[model samples]
Each structure stands twice: as C-alpha cells, then as structure tokens.
Target: MVEKHTPSFIRKGSGKKKADTTEQFEKAVSRLAEGKYVLRLYVAGMTPNSARAIANLKKICEEHLAGRYDLNVIDVYRKPTLAKGEQIIAAPTLIKKLPLPMRKLIGDMSDEGKVLIGLDIRTR
Candidate 1:
C-alpha cells in the first residue's frame, strides 16, 4: 500500500492561516491602488518648452491624478545643486518619485499617452 503525503499548507486547521494571508495581501493591494503619487518637474528656466511642460504636466495631473498627487516644480537655473543631485542632463524632465520603481520622462510632456504610461495611470 502506498501512503499519500499531503502538503503542509493542506494540513488540517490551515484554512485560518490561509485566509489571514489572503486578507493581508488584499489590504496591501488596496493601499497601493489608493496611494498618493509624488512627482518632480525639473526645468532650465521659464522658457517656452519649460512653460509647455509645466502646463502639460499640470493638466495631466489634474485630469488623472487629481488630489492624489504632489508635484514640485524645480528651476534648474536657480537650483543648480538640486539639478545636479538628481543628475538631470536635460531640461523639461518629469520624475516620478513615489510608488516605487522611479521613472523619468524627458520632453515637453505633450504626449499624453506616453506620460500616462510612464506615470502608471490607468486610462478607461
């Protein structure tokens, strides 16, 4: 006669532990879905490109992120040290600082699709 071995997780009285773990994982996912976004926009100066980037970013944030985002606009011309710290080699760069896996988008931010993808915003 062959004896069948049951997995440890399938042992008796393990249902409670499995249920607890599942609940915890669900809570974590919920928190992440509702987490706030932190972003920074680094620009050279108040030039045309910078202006466009700022406007575009603000619009995008208001439309998608709404009140769940914190945006900081930095003038590299005035705050050279800050720019150097972030290793910014180009103007009109948007950095997503929160929600892990930081991302950088460089341009006038006119491409809404690309910006949305970079920011990990869901589009319906």
Candidate 2:
C-alpha cells in the first residue's frame, strides 16, 4: 500500500504544537524509510520511440516498483520549459530521483536489463 502523510502545521506559543510537529516529522521520516522511488521520463513527442519508452517504463514500474514509485512523464514537445529545466539533451530519457544516488538512463527503454540496472531496480 502507498503511504501518504499529511503535514501537521505547528502553531505559535504552544509547547503541545512543538511536540506534535516533532512527532509528525518522525512519522514522515519513518514512512520514507521503505524507500520511495521518484522517476521522471522525458520524451520528445508522440513518436514511436517515445511511446515505446513509456510502455516499457510503465511495465517495469508495475513489476518492480508498484506503489512505491511516482512516475512523471514529460513531453518536451508540449512543455519545452520542463525539458530545459532538466537539461535534457536527448529524447526518451529516464531520471531516477529517489532512493539516493540519482541516475539517468537514456534510450527507448527497449533493453529491460539496462533500464533496471540504471534505475537501481536491480543489483549489477
């Protein structure tokens, strides 16, 4: 199951609020301890390569990551600003942003082994 925590705001001049905030923060930290995966897939357009990459990525995430992952698919054709922000120099790029030691994999994601390894889904 996916873990979701609502941030508790601390009120001023209340010792109880401070303790509650600390407790909430610890709970949030504990929830993340299971290792949540944040992924971004950048595609140029609705080309064959882009479609394939999206399909492959979805399959991999369903099989390997399931509820533990958040996949954000960004189309450079539609939103060039997002592409520029990430400094993407190629189409069909996958960026793994969580679980520490961020990684980027470039391709249509045809090679499942390479994609899995690149995303730290599997040990090399």
Evaluate all candidate structures by whole-model CA lDDT and list the values in order.
0.71, 0.70
Highest-scoring model, TM-score: 2
Which RMSD values do the candidates have, in order? 19.1, 10.2
> Which TM-score value belongs to model 2?
0.72
TM-score of model 1 vs. true structure? 0.70
Clashing pairs in 1: none
lDDT of 2: 0.70
- Model 2 collision count: 0
Which stretches in model 1 have alpha-carbon errors above 4 Å?
Answer: 1-34
Error of 2 at 53 (Å): 0.4
